[model samples]
Target: MTLGHSTRLIAVAFALAGPFGLASQPSWAEPTQGWKSYIERDYQAAEKHWRTDVARGNPNGAFGLAILAERAGDAKGATEWYEKAALGGVPSAQVLTGQRYAEGVGVERNPVRAYAWFARAMAAGVPNAEKLRDRLAATMTPSQIKEADALAETLAKP
Candidate 1:
């Protein structure tokens, strides 16, 4: 290798080695350009890109696949991937999961659970979550709302 490249590689290796050594360094996965493929209207390529990370529980891959599934009219597949991404901490996936729960789409309708998911999205800094939470709250009775509010607070905690 060139001296410059070798120096950079050495620096990176040292950086990756922490106080606890290499074992303490965070593991990284390869770049998966799933979103780019999906945006280009290429479902096949998007699927291929995203599949590389799905087994590793990458939220971006799950979220991209969810969008692709939805575009292809596969509600079941969409919900499944949405749930995976949501659990993996994707804010959009959390919002979508909330909507699904509220509407009984590919899952049971449960407003309380929906509210919690919305709150979780809000906690994760998804700005659209507030409106959805407020709208859903309007349909609930005072007691149900209290429960949902409590759930929201609980879900918001780290």
Candidate 2:
């Protein structure tokens, strides 16, 4: 589906929230609260809801908060939460974390680390991962690329 820049960003955040975007799963008794507020563009409400969810140790909530923080210009908050959710196996969050590392936005510059994250997210089957990996590779030396590939391989394992 086509999305505007803002919607596309939201979609990436929500894409991993459930099997579908902004739609709660039957597995949750109260439905996904963040999705509702996010769909309505009530980001403050969404942030509140996601914060609640995050406190409950929900990976989706962590991912949602990361996106909202990014939208709200809290790059550090976004980066922290993205790393948290990424470790929990949120593919989109993994991609976002990789991008952050690649750009040094709210994080230290580390191309090798960024390439590793892209590799991990790619292994997780995120869309456009191959393209992202290739783009970063262009800025890397052959040895750095090889190191990143190995690191990605290591991280990709269960």
Candidate 3:
């Protein structure tokens, strides 16, 4: 039985490795290449690859594409992609979307929405979010602050 189990494990490993071996590059290499293109300022190439990855449900790819859109001056596209990434649980995207809401960049300014997003990012452990949350708190009335805090607490719940 032990020998049979070991053989079965080895077979599964070989099956997984087969596709990787046959390809000149591993399947996961595309996302890395896409990120490198982004870092090198090749926005079009990065967008192409990242869009493909995003279509396949890659959260990092969605975040990268959103950031590229923002840097490329496509505010509408950036907002859409950033929202998608944030919904997909990318903390940086949540923080950026919140900042945009706070500053009235791309979208209309809405302090409540901004605070909610910052709170989400803070809950996710984005260290800078806490500072932003405090700053946002300073701009609100007591009731508004209480509302925002309640919203944040609700979002923090699993």
Using TM-score as the measure, which candidate wins?
2
TM-score of each: 0.70, 0.75, 0.71
lDDT of 1 by residue, 89-146 (tens): 6666778778888998888799998988887776766666878888998898888877
Candidate 2 lDDT by residue in tens digits, 1-158: 76655577766545533332221334433546787998888988898998888787666688788777777788898899888877666667778788899999989978888898888777776767768889999999999998988877765232
TM-score of 3: 0.71
Error of 2 at 11 (Å): 3.6
C-alpha lDDT of candidate 2 relative to the true structure: 0.74
Q: What's model 1's TM-score?
A: 0.70
Task: Give lDDT: candidate 1, residue 141.
Answer: 84
Candidate 2, which segments miss by more than 4 Å at Cα?
1-6, 12-31, 153-158
Give the worst 10-residue stretch by lDDT in candidate 1: 16-25
Task: Report how far residue 147 has shifted in candidate 2, in Å.
Answer: 3.9
Candidate 3: tens digits of C-alpha lDDT, residues 48-158: 888887787666577677667666677877777766766666666677777778988888888987898788877776667888888998998888877877776665232
**1 versus 2: better lDDT goes to:** 2
